[model samples]
Target: MPNDHYEAEQSVISGPKGKVRADSIQFFKFDGKSEVDPQKLAKDLEQLRAAVRQVPDVDPDERDRAVAALLAAQDAATEGDEVKVRANLKRVGKWVLNVAESIGVGVAIAVLRQVVASG
Candidate 1:
């Protein structure tokens, strides 16, 4: 077994008229032989949920869908299923981009990359 790592980079948009924006990136690496950490995944999902909830002037339905996607991603991650986790994360990324666009926020492009190697 080796180490498995996942990384995501996104643009965060804020400020009046969405004039301010910054790149937000995170990395998560874990021992492939061990179980994935559900708590860490849950915490990350919580933060994303909160961010969606904070966005103003977004359609209620869209917001709800985005939150649901995050929840699904969390569940997939908890199961230690890399395939499902990746799929759900892609779904969440799309929803986030839609939410950002609807709220007049700067465009957000989420790029997810994974690396696995035997140690």
Candidate 2:
């Protein structure tokens, strides 16, 4: 693992010892700048927000929750907070994955993934 070139857009901890309890882990940040294009991510997040709004099966409350997640994702992207953006996007995706194809949500999320991948 080369710290200088490591782009950990996602991470997972597994195995028997991976059971992380609250206050059991210590985290630290490396002073590395992100290569992701914040503007591109923000644009796709906006599209995702629109797509979420058009989900016919989602009730008003659910739609609102999804949109809130998108907005948080957008904000995080603008600030180059990749982890937060992905977490928020996951929240939105979980809220509407079943109806993804019914609207443009699937496409929107895919585009966002591309933006992050190439950023």
Candidate 3:
């Protein structure tokens, strides 16, 4: 009798991560986060979606327009949207610094309160 208990799985080379295991790979995917694979076009679209989701009662037409604009921006990026990309990078850097500063201040306040309670 032939053994039928074991099945062999195959591997495929897809991206930089070579030899992708069949059981460990996903084909269709959508990450809701803004910064997925930074080089991926889908990441830009996801960022646009996240920004659109923030507005109160956003109109369908407006959302469509935004998506169109994002596509154009992606094209421009492909054609070297250097100025816009640099500006955005700078803005994000500043925003991150501000957030870190706020969190540091909050932590300092909590620590001071704890010290006061102890003393």
Candidate 4:
């Protein structure tokens, strides 16, 4: 396994008169392409699915949709099609972020954002 780290910084201005400002900085760890293993990827995706399912205050329908997206991503990975795998993963990441944000799971949302953006 290859351990690679990346950092991202973001700033936002909102609210009336644009007086409110928010900033966020995050560090993400990426799995190296050369080190990718299908079995490991499947396991990791399952873990992420479980985490999403465990989030509190999440709509059941939303959670089911997110899990379905993850399963599709896993199927894509099993086929060893890099393009399809990336596409499905991107879909899964987006759904994950949506669910996370709905339930106020800030950490998961930030992590998913980094994963989706980095890819």
Candidate 5:
């Protein structure tokens, strides 16, 4: 019989001291204040979605991903999860920053910059 992986748990490391390497890292800080207005961000994202659709340079797949990221960020903002909001917005910025000007989402670009510039 083949042994199942993780049938028993082992090798647990609990502390701030370790090699600490990963392909990605998620940092969530709760500073006790909402950084963005969820309602306004939702409206901006809708505008952004319309703009992205009209952009000839953005492919279907990229458009889909960016839209999804923006929606996720909006949801995170509404839920008061700053880390998820910023992370998702960072994904949107990475996907569309180069074409943001062309897409005419200037306000959006600026907003995203404030959130993701530090990222």
Candidate 6:
């Protein structure tokens, strides 16, 4: 299909053993910068509305329970990620402090040796 500013094309792909499949993919690329297309936006909204309507309906209490379960699961996942991040940070911090302290002690010892030799 061809329009004033947008064009669409299709292609067919053949799988292994000569199985052919037709793909109905539409590519809408603008030739130049343009304003929003109201028609396309309306069509997209309608499609979304239809999809939402297809979802199963639950009673209010059941819906609340489902929402609570989802929130609990999300909180658990977040906490798990946070725990892992903190553990890794703590491990890295410990290694860094160890390295820093070793360097500090070496520098102190070298300074003391220099002072004693000068005296």
Each model's lDDT: 0.51, 0.59, 0.37, 0.58, 0.61, 0.31
Which segments of candidate 2 are over 4 A away from where they belong? 1-11, 14-36, 94-119
Give the clashing pairs for model 4: none
**TM per prediction:** 0.46, 0.54, 0.28, 0.49, 0.54, 0.22
Better of 4 and 5 by lDDT: 5
Candidate 3 residue-wise lDDT, 34-107, digit = tens: 22232343344345435544545546665556545445534534444433332333322222223324444332
Lowest-scoring 10 consecutive residues by lDDT in candidate 4?
7-16
Off by over 4 Å in 4: 1-33, 93-115
lDDT of 5 by residue, 1-119 (tens): 24433432223233345364445442333344434455555566667766766667767787888878877876775676666766787777455655555566654565676555556
Candidate achieving higher lDDT, 2 or 6: 2
Clashing pairs in 6: none
lDDT comparing candidate 4 with the true structure:
0.58
Q: Candidate 6 at 77: error in angstroms?
A: 0.2
Q: Which pairs in model 1 have colliding backbones? A: none
Ranking by lDDT: 5, 2, 4, 1, 3, 6
Model 2 over residues 1-119: C-alpha lDDT tens digits?
Answer: 23334344343354444554443332212124433456665876676677778877867887998899889978987786766766676665454544444455443455344333333
Q: What lDDT does model 1 reach?
A: 0.51
Q: List the residue pairs that clash in candidate 2.
A: none
Stretches of candidate 5 exceeding 4 Å from the true structure: 1-35, 94-107
Q: When superposed on Cα atoms, how far off is each prediction in RMSD? A: 14.1, 9.5, 19.0, 11.8, 8.2, 30.5
Model 6 poorest 10 in a row by lDDT = 85-94
Kindly list the per-residue Cα lDDT of model 1 for residues 1-119, writing each as its tens digit. 14544444432343334564324334343346433454565556656667788877778877777778777766766665555555565654355655444544221222123211100
Candidate 2 vs. truth: CA RMSD?
Answer: 9.5
Candidate whose lDDT is highest: 5
